[model samples]
Target: MALILRDIAVARGGVPVLEGVSARIETGQALILRGPNGIGKTSLLRAVAGLQPLLEGTVEPDTGQMAYGAHADGIKAQMSVAENLRFWAGLHGTSDIDAALTAFSLDGLAGRLAATLSAGQKRRVGLARLLVTGRPIWLLDEPTVSLDTASTALFGQAVDAHLRRGGTALIATHVGCGIDAPVLDLAPYKAKPRDLAGFGGNGGFA
Candidate 1:
């Protein structure tokens, strides 16, 4: 199975952001969305995840089985690391909390309160939720944020494992994440007129 996007148009806050974008993410592969800020990378990811409406075109992924990770960690302060994972696992009808914890190096911090963990730790816990969700498609936005070198490697390995099992991922980030995936630069799909006019031909509004 694959996640397919056909000439889709994405918007944010009712304003058009990206237009005429098409991509196909085959099984066991990852597609990285790269571009400057405000270029609609997040909006595109949101559209594919079914969290936002597409102004036009079609998304043919089994969106019902997709898991999305946004910029926030999404951990409740009152919840323990394990509790947080269990909550999502239950939501996804899964019981893979142990595997999730081990993947993100959170096995030792399972009993720690989410609020007490460092930024990197919290991010790890947030990422671990993806594994427990048991979803084949991962739509991640800035997933490596706050991750140190070692933690970043852990995240990459987790992604690699997911792909090995016939999973697919679409990642939006400014920095590369060590995944040997084709880079889809969102700049080319940016909405016309305003994007060119607002940026003064330099692709940035300065």
Candidate 2:
């Protein structure tokens, strides 16, 4: 599945942030989003994921084909590592989670409760959820936040495998995920001050 965005505008806190943004991410490819903080990278991803509405333009297909991962881990503190993966897998109509555990190197910690794991360990578990989603497109924001050097590499490998399996990803990150993907810098798309001032704050429309 190809993810396409055309002349899209996104907002944050009811203020216009990015406009005139366009990009096409095809299957088996990853596009890295880059920009300074508060430049609407997160807002753009949210718009793409359908968590928020687009002020203009369109995103091809619907959110059903996409899986979004944000800064929040979305893990249940009470569930064990294996149990968590099982929960997501079931939601996506998948039953096998062994591959996901191996991809993030979580095999050893599978039985441990999420609350008992360290930050990096929990991060790996969080990322591993992507595999169980069964969706072709991944919209991730700062996925490597609490990861260590080695853990980051593990994530990169998971992305590599995802691409090989014909999945697409749009990732917002400062550090590299070690994938040979093109970068889409959001700097040029920064919404002009004039544009922000004119927004009616009626959910980013007009």
Candidate 3:
């Protein structure tokens, strides 16, 4: 299964953000969205995840089962660490909290308030949601945000494992995460005037 984009275009605040961008990510590979700030890296990710409205174009993945994690970690501050994971997994109808926390090194903090965790700790908790839910495609925005070298390495290992298991991922990051994947920059594709009715790209590799 693959995710394909065809002649996609997007506009925000009445300005074109991405135009004619095209790429196809497959079942066992990863794709990186690289660009300067305001070039629509995050916007592109959101569009791919179906979280944002596309002005023009299309996003078609061979399958609909997916995972999307943003830079914010999206952990609820008022909830316990495990409680937060429970809430996220609940969205996917998952009930295995122990295994989920264990996989992310979060079992020890199960009862700890997520608000009391450090920035790096919180990022782990957020990433754990993806693992626990067991989605096939992962759309991650800055998966290593606020992490130290060790934490970053841990995150890297997790992603590597995910790829090894044939889970596709689309990641947006300014800082490199030691994972090897094909890269796509939006600017070159966006230089031309666009229709901005939707966003997508068409690409093929043989």
Candidate 4:
């Protein structure tokens, strides 16, 4: 399995959030985590990416082979588009950044600082980082949030290509994301809404 989460359980300050979450995502597949606001969608993605600990589960990943893009974009405002790619490319041990910059329509923004670009442009910069990782598993949280229609399509195309190349993905987003992937809704697995910080006591969405 490219990514696997089994018997996953999470609690915050003694309140349960997710329970008995299990899934296996193999190469050439995508898993879409769809849920209302809060309800641990982002938390689940974070845990899968090893950013957050799994309270009661196991996540086995192929080391140095994943990219995590959060809803916030995680772009450095002071750096230009090319500059940002250069930094991440270097960090990921990549020797090329030009192809990534061009893929995200950032060639023209190479001279402009990230702070000066619009939200969509910043998102492109953030997504461009994926090109440097060369990882097979991509963990994306609301990756299309700040993107325009064109950019969203562009991102989707990138994902499709990745899947074609035997890559895997786990995405957390409310929208369809327009990718072919199994969707796991936390609503049913989460017995009660009030079990977590983001869920109401009635097992209702946040």
Best model per lDDT: 2
Instruction: Give Cα-based local distance difference scores for all models.
Output: 0.87, 0.91, 0.77, 0.78
Q: What would the per-residue lDDT of candidate 2 be over residues 1-206, giving only the tens digit for each residue?
A: 78999888878987779988999999899999999999999999999999998887789878999999999999999999999999999999999999999999999999999999999999999999999999999999999999998898999999989889999999999888777899999999999866554544223555
Q: Which regions of candidate 2 fall more than 4 Å away from where they truly are?
A: 195-204
Comparing 3 with 4 on lDDT, the higher-scoring candidate is 4
For model 2 the TM-score comes to: 0.95
What range of 10 consecutive residues in model 4 has the weakest lDDT sum?
Answer: 197-206
lDDT of 3 by residue, 1-206 (tens): 46687666665565667767788888788898888878887777777777766666678873357788887888899999988888987888887878667667887899999889998899889988888777888888988888888878777778878878888788888888978898897768654554433334331100
Error of 2 at 150 (Å): 1.3
lDDT measured at residue 151 in model 4 versus the true structure, 0 to 100: 91
What is the per-residue lDDT of model 4 for residues 154-199, given as tens digits with 9 covering 90 to 100? Answer: 8888888889889888898887666877889887666454534443
Residue-by-residue lDDT tens digits, candidate 1, 94-119 = 87799999999999999999999999
Q: How accurate is candidate 1 locally (lDDT)?
A: 0.87
The model with the greatest TM-score is 2
Candidate order (lDDT)? 2, 1, 4, 3
Clashing pairs in 1: none
Q: Predictions ranked by TM-score, top down?
A: 2, 1, 4, 3
lDDT value, residue 32 of candidate 1: 94
